[model samples]
Target: MANTHEMTVPVTRPTAARQPHPSGRRLTAHLASVADDLTALWQRLEDDPAVAFHQGRAWVEAWREATGANLCLVTLEQDGAAVAMLPLEIKRSCGLSIARFAGTAFSNENTGLLDSVRLADLAPVTADELALTLSQAGLGADVVLFDKLTPATAADAPYSALPKVFHQNPSFQLPLFADFSAVLAQINGKRRRKKMRVSERRLEAMGGYRHLIGEDDALALRLLETFFRQKALRFAAQGLPDVFADPAVRTFLRILATDRDANGRAALELHGLELAGGDHEGEIIAVSGLTLKHGHVTCQFGSINDVIAADVSAGELLFYRMIERAALAGHKLFDFGVGDQSYKRSWCPQRTELVDCYVPLNLKGRLAAPLIAGMIRLKRVIKTSPGLHRLATWLRGLPVRRQKAAAEPD
Candidate 1:
């Protein structure tokens, strides 16, 4: 049965309350059908450095609204205060109900639930108490799969401490120094400056350009539409799938850009480089979306106007502007998010380790776990091996390559 508001269960003891929890304190898992239940808890931890923006209440709610995914929140409360929680979107697949972290496919990293208090180190539990509780609590999930987890995840609890394999693609981030020059030194300062100078001269000749931040809601929405068009064209050129082709995704991104909290902190922020007064005056050259929380900022996605993108390097210039602003604002890290692009590698020096964890709650899950694990392993090998990765890319691009060859004058 699908999770419903009627299935909402209050905070209570775990159904499998046999032994004491390893933390010497109870961390009981409870089922909540509505994500609104987290509003109160989110208020307490919204600013907590431990709580990532991907797990932020607004971000989660936006995803749910946009995708219409069934929400099944598993909250662990201790002494009445919520210590940790997992907001999952239950999906039925292969005769089994699988509970996955909401927005997992789009998220850069998953920090499997962590105690908000950051309590002292606790011994690892042999059994997955959270999973056990979830199984019996009956949200109708046969398996709980958590993936794209960063190595920085807390691992004392059963849910997070289980055996796992490295995730497909590791995330990347760069330290943001207050002095912009100091930041440059960490990533080929000389070469970066030379490129920046060249881009500046080119842009200057083209009636100059201005970096525009989407502070205005209307302008931000417009920029977002432009980004979609740019990305669709780019993806078509590369023969890659257009992830943004889904209307739901577009709606989700729009919500992220518009929905804001009392503090004006929206789930997504947009920035672009626009032509000032050239023949294509006011036309956007590059667009980027970002998510910021506490002192960390992550690039969600970016697109460029490829037709006129030869020597201007609009994308790089936009990043330089944003990175400088982030650094000046004292943000600690500028994450490049998921993927292994040449630009990401050159910009971000720190590679964050990622992992996946799967817990089977029933016979069906147990039977299917191995198959799922094997597939994940294969994907990891392909992503991590340079030769395999190159071959895979070449294969994926074959259609476009073949088309171009056929169109050439013989």
Candidate 2:
């Protein structure tokens, strides 16, 4: 059911955290790459309301295709029947092998073990047993880190028992009403309408603009590239890191945007605003990638080209266009994904908190965990403290000048 393609890599490192009985009769765990055996369970778990789009079949397949990351399917069995599963990617962090959920990054709002409820209900020894099992299974990871975990996962057992930190930035959400007018009321309706009209007039006077949903694969890929460029420019302007810098990530976006499920719904959909004809003819000013699932619309990524029309507020206008569509289509929730930007807050009155769960499997992990946590916490501090954030932003913007000055040599 997952359309799986994964290869289990051999564990070469010494098992530093193995248990005396890694495979106890009552609780045995095995590792594999293929998920075909767990298709039924995957389907059942996916049907659960807590399962987000990131873990859906199509999204997983697209990710695998894009990066071809090493996969580890850890299945736990109780009395010969499967009871829990963990889908992990074996990655190298520092000198340690790190195990993380495949879709940990890229600002997705969810990641959790497939058997959250069951895993939590497992015996008290399950946590230690799991660590030993992971070591024996050859995942070769010193620790397991599941970031951006939903509330359900955070409230559950083994994970809940482990160290966790709340996400620095929670996801912002806008609740949709029966109509666009009603939805606009959540924010200042009249002000928004006037702003929209102003934006439309500016764009209309410049030439003409059109809202588009990229249904065709070719067009979608083109808009995705535009998004990349705009985002890079935006990040550079803001002196922020560009997370979409990876080539594999671009391929990943392309695959997801083009892939449609049996119901003809795509796991990722691309939408944009394009200038029909003007000085910058056929240029896309704004782009938004979204996923529509269970009547919810979550924006995965978005960008705007202010170089064309700064006064037009193309990004906000594009959001208005997208949210209006979601409202008209009867989508209940419009999620701005993970971040707390002023624009997102201006429209969203709801927020979803995320948790980062960390578990140290061995001595190496025990030593490294604190350093990692410290860095995360430090980042959070910097983000929350306006003075520190401004200072950091200034430093980021100075790297280029610093390099140039250093090169000038005495």
Best by TM-score: 1
lDDT tens per residue, model 1, 217-328: 8988988999999999998887766789899999999999998767776668899999887788889999999998888899999999998755798999999989999999
Per-residue accuracy of model 2 over 365-397 as CA lDDT, tens digit each: 889987877777787788878999889878877
The C-alpha lDDT values of all candidates are 0.77, 0.74
TM-score of each: 0.87, 0.84
In model 1, where is the ten-residue run with the lowest total lDDT? 1-10
TM-score of 1: 0.87
Clashing pairs in 1: none
